[model samples]
Target: MRGTIQNRDEFLSKVAGQLGQRSFTEGVERPKWKYQPQHAVLKDAGSDELLEILKMQCTKIHTDFFVSGKSGLMETLKTVVSNYGGGPILTWKDSRFDTIGLTPLFKQIWPEENVEINEWESSRGEENIELAEKANVGITISDITLAESGTAVLFSSKDRGRTVSFLPAKSVILIPKSTIVPRMTQATKIMREKVKNGEHVASCINFITGPSNSADIESRLVVGVHGPTKATYIVIEDL
Candidate 1:
């Protein structure tokens, strides 16, 4: 056994020697252009144009998109819940929801006996994960929306746990139109700025393009294997 272990060690050392130290240290060079051809076109687009592009790309990626004003948001959310057969919902404890008065709407739509609405709480560590796993739908607020890729950016923190977006079978994101950006570059810049300003940045930043899907097993496409099977984006125009 000792002889075999030594031989294996010798083989690994030889392989590492051949690769050399520089091979691991040297990183790939970044692209020179600020934006690629596809992304460049969206750089100067107006809010309306960006929204249109976001809608088109989201549709292509099989994500349901809905638009609603501040006044109509409650009805829109009710419709979404009703369409999903009124299951348990997990949501973030963000101020944005309070600003729009979502708590009352939730109470009105989903009564105590009918549906369970689990608002994220930091104190409930393992309990939160358990709730998220059982939750039929997870609802969150998107900090940034990449219009070019139709991606929603979520920064996981105490108020907004990562499990709410990942463990559920379906997800609903409440996105403000003002948070929509053209590309990832703009999003990263904002994140960097927050870090520089000594803000409480989250440990995990999730960039969700659409529903979780994989074609790994026999090349047959499967959805919701690792995450939500369906994702809905509610873009609030008045926010």
Candidate 2:
């Protein structure tokens, strides 16, 4: 016969101690992937081809375009946005990107928008949600991302919040085309590797395909949920 445990702390501590024993720590000092790198097969197009796609997608004439914390995005976005009458460009000062000295690059492109930086980040939830909902464009970075599927992976946590990507009407993504894999199978393999390496996985992983859409209510296609309606991926060349 076993005695009943009355103290909650003792029970929790016993369980936690047992669980901590199998804590993963081996092979925790490597990039998420080593053996099978993502396969990025470029689909070459004419010089104006990219522009034509943008037009066909109905990119707004004077709309905000969110820029993610990715390599080459700063320079490319400056060139691209300047050509199209730049609007708001979004970014995070996360260590993952800033440690690589990418923050300064972003500062160079469209510095005017920084006039209200503190106000933007410190805004209340209702205001933030409203901004996300009303804004026409958004951008995001990726981790353990996929290019073949034209998908961008974003983990909403801490400073890198979810509303930045979801509430917007249209969202754009910047990904290193080299990180594009052929299938989900390969993607998961890399994820497993990251875990084995003792990397801290994000609390929430957002796999954005094209954009936010639904066919609810008599099959009437409706874009924009509590999320974006149109989403596009601008695959950046691997440096």
* C-alpha TM-score for every candidate: 0.81, 0.56
- Cα-based lDDT at residue 111, candidate 2: 55
Estimate, for each residue in 1-239, the C-alpha lDDT of model 1 and write its tens digit: 12334576567667778888333334757569774675565678899999999999998778899999999998898888778766788888787787876878665557654677878889977888888999989999899999989999999888899889989889899899999999898898799899989997777999998899888758878878899999899999986
Top lDDT hit: 1
Residue 201 local lDDT, model 2: 70
Per-candidate total of colliding backbone pairs = 0, 2
Model 1 CA deviation exceeding 4 Å by range: 1-41, 107-109, 217-220
Q: What are the lDDT figures for the candidates, one per model?
A: 0.85, 0.52
Error of 1 at 125 (Å): 1.7
Pairs of residues at least 3 apart in sequence or in different chains that clash in candidate 2: 28-197, 224-229
Off by over 4 Å in 2: 1-75, 79-86, 95-105, 113-136, 216-220
